[model samples]
Target: MSRIGRLWNSLANPDRIPKLFAIVLGAVILIGFLIPLDLNVDQLYPRPVPQEQVEENISTAPYARGGEVLESPGITRAQYPENSKSLGWINSYMSPLAIWVASTSPYFGTSIYSSPGGLIDEILYYTRGFDTILESTILMMAFVIASWLGVNFTMNRKKREAEAAADKSKDYYDPTLNKNKTYYYNNQNSNIKEEQD
Candidate 1:
């Protein structure tokens, strides 16, 4: 057969199914990592906390001495600068989640109340829990398949070695025998009988 045909046959072998599956899974993970995440801030946080309210609260706080508050404006998307393209893209997409988490977290003292640990806990336990479970299950199955294949290969090798050893022992020469032990014994018995007669 041709080289391509042989390669195809090898790849299609049932014994290699686990390896093929692992390769596919690895490719999927690679693709997922390469794809950029797109998140809309407006959709994630429909009602953001007003900047005026935050500033007012900070200004009137006991920490503010002589009722003086910092008047510097916060950084906007247009004003933000980044040197790396990949990092910039990641920051733009992930900033919404960060904003949502910070705004909803009880630690930040926002108007919206969230459970302890906030949005992060909710996403991990509720939204993304199934994906985590499936990933772990697939990993475990791959490990099991690899271990089973290794064990079977070792067992088969040992069995072949034992068979070879047995064959070698059977084929060895015997010092007490001539060409064949049975024939040598038969001929000797016949000669003894003839002499007795």
Candidate 2:
């Protein structure tokens, strides 16, 4: 058969159903991470300062009293930056933070780059270090538990099968039949053989 036919048969097998489900679930999670969804910054950081209040405070501040304000604070929008895409969030916020750490940190300074490996390193070692560690530890513990359970299940099944086989063999044996068998005896003094039934 062809490779596709073999793969289809494997996927259809009951024993591989769980493994296939895990692969599909993992793929979905990977895709979700890779594809960034558009989100509102204001919704994420909802606390808003009034434009007038900010202007008054800046104008009254000692340094700003003499200097002119270059740009004025604009009106607060319910959702700021209309039609903003997901890339903006990464470029404006996450990338700068990651770049700063990659540049300044001695451990990551040399290896960190604008590549996928660098992004993974930044997440695993810097951004979400504790979370990554916890996730890995949890996955390890789950695997160990699953393996132990599987071993115990197979052992118990084998033990039960052996007991069943022993019981089946015992059903073929009869003590009454053995007792009724003819017995032959030799008499040494008389030099004669006797048979009893």
Candidate 3:
């Protein structure tokens, strides 16, 4: 069999069961994205507006209560939000979206009240906490990585200095190894010349 085919067979064996676990984990993440999970916001938190206020606004019939927009007789110029142009439609659409997100999903849902306006507040409030935590974690991780790099650099520098000290010279030779010396006997040169004659 081909090498690649053998590898495939090996991976398919029961011994490589960890691949199944990895597949399961990937599936869970995909499902989480498709079907949102519950957030841990109790009803007590962030304070629900008083029911009396709601009832009063309803009785008055002119003022809008947060999301609720009211239509009036002979008022053609009924100023409504661009998305919620009229009270009736605005109340109809936004209410359900907010309730669904807030009550069902991990997102804290739409903030009905905001400084400047409600929609801007909703955008900021729901996402602010996560953004803050993410930023903070990234900053902290960067600091840690930088510190680790500095320590490693210092250690490597010290090691090089120690090595340089040990290797003071590379052409190292023991003095005892050069004990033998050469001698020249030029005095015997005249005797060699007389024999040759």
User: Would you estimate the TM-scores of all the predictions?
Assistant: 0.27, 0.27, 0.22
Candidate 1: C-alpha lDDT? 0.47
**RMSD, model 1, all Cα superposed?**
21.6
Worst 10 residues of 3 by lDDT: 175-184
Candidate that beats the other on lDDT, 1 or 3, i.e. the better one: 1
Worst 10 residues of 1 by lDDT: 60-69
Cα lDDT for residue 114, candidate 3: 15
Instruction: Compose the digit string of candidate 3's lDDT tens values, residues 63-150.
Output: 2224433333111222223532432223212344544553453323223321223332332333243666687899999999998877
**Which candidate leads the pack in lDDT?**
1
Residue 115 of model 3 has an lDDT of: 20
Candidate 2 at 169: error in angstroms?
A: 19
For model 2, the stretches where C-alpha displacement exceeds 4 angstroms are 1-38, 42-115, 160-197
Q: Which residue runs does candidate 3 get wrong by more than 4 Å?
A: 1-24, 33-41, 47-145, 154-197
Q: Provide the lDDT at 41 for model 1.
A: 68
Residue range 1-197, candidate 1, lDDT tens digits: 68877678667556688988899999999999888998776553133355643566542121111211123212122212352122112211213453476445433433233222323322344445577789899999999998897776654656654555567557654423223665877789779656643
1 or 2, greater by lDDT: 1
- Roughly what TM-score does model 3 have, to 2 decimal places? 0.22
- In model 2, the Cα lDDT at residue 196 comes to 13
lDDT of 2 at 91: 16
Score residue 81 of candidate 1 by CA lDDT.
30
